[model samples]
Target: MSDPGLPPLSRQHDRRLRQMYRSAGWPCQDTVEIELLAAGLLERRLEPSGREYLRVTDLGIARLAQALDRNRAALDAHEALVLRVAEEAQRAGRIAYRGLGLLAKPGERWLQLRPDVYSIRNTSVEDYLEPVVHEIKVRRADLLSDLKKPDKRAGYLALAGECYYVLQQGIAEPEEIPPECGVMIASASRIEVARLAPKRPMKPGFATWMVLAKAAPCRQPLEPEPRL
Candidate 1:
């Protein structure tokens, strides 16, 4: 539970947080939009194009000022990219999330390597399951640092049906990545597929299937019915 005085922010609040502040163009599924409106944090106004716009309000600013500490706890660059990419993938029918929907084993050892982020398309046997894995690289040094680890390559290739390197825009060029892997840039306002990842299934172990079995639409079951 959150402190009585603190503005409500926790793991349960991620969807709400993103709903209230993500780009107006970004899709929202949670009731956070409505809550923000009720709290006077957001106003439902029309854009020049006649589309509804949920712009922040002065009262919302005041509320946010009181939530400065909580906001700081909630926002971070690495997770921000993960959130954007995950949300985008969900929109595209990808739901299973690493460390979320995709759970690690009860007593896992160093041999099992988890992708920074990943999603599964479907779980049905006859249907082909698309496993998309992403390695979030916020800093060039972090990217270079991981490059030295040979296991990272072997791990991703064995688990991901399609692999992607999700980096901040201008952080690295698409040419830096191989033709098989895709390159996605997380821009300030949006996530762009700078390069499409090629599809290739890698034979995975039983541990991998365990993770895929848990794939669902979004973390919030009541939210938008995941198209997945």
Candidate 2:
């Protein structure tokens, strides 16, 4: 737990603290440093030659650990939801990939976008592949932050015939998301579709095809051995 008496620190502060702990404590001499120093999370040291460097205090280490734990928990939640989505796709006879990177040109500039879950219908016909992109968010802050990036959303739209946002339950209402994208709310029991994503006609470019060919799709679960 953070000390209530101390000034609240942001993730940037935690990041700087970790960087300083890893490196030779070269000071950035910025407001983040001042805030950390004020909160006693960092201390300054002077050598005999008058060179000054920064050091993270014990309290800072504790804060870093806390941040790491929170991040890990969020990551676990995100990955679990991603796995569920991928499995759901497989059950629907689609080939799904997690963490697949691809280039998208939503605007004049091409952007690199890695949709949390990318899938295509399992079919022999290339035109019938129906590529889809699913972006997962377990945290409201992350979802809101992503919403602010129109270019990123555009990039996702460019790559898929259908784009969806799979959010943890209660993070946000379906109305909060843009109309172009679909919304799925995930709970402990099941995932429910809040809104259907509008489908568009799209053909995966040669680059997308190359990447998909090289990457592995999520494996289907194994069946139990038959009893004799």
Best by TM-score: 2
For 1-228, candidate 2 gives per-residue lDDT tens digits of 455886788888888999999999888999999989988899999989899999899998898999999999999999999999999899889999999989999889999889999999999998899999999999999999999999999999999999999999999999999999999999999998999999998989988999999999999956579999
lDDT of 1: 0.64
Best by lDDT: 2
How does candidate 2 fare on TM-score? 0.90
**RMSD in order of candidates:** 16.9, 2.3
Model 2 lDDT, residue 226, Cα: 100
For model 2 the local lDDT of residue 145 reads 96
- Give the CA lDDT, 0 to 100, for residue 107 in model 2: 85
Q: Model 1, 1-228: lDDT tens per residue?
A: 223554554333443544556566342535655555555556777779787766666765565565665556434777777777777777776564744333223233334566767776644552466777888877776677776765555557666678899988877888887666789988889888899988876444576666555554346223666696
Error of 2 at 145 (Å): 2.0
How well does candidate 2 score on lDDT at residue 166? 97
- The weakest ten consecutive residues by lDDT in model 1 span 100-109
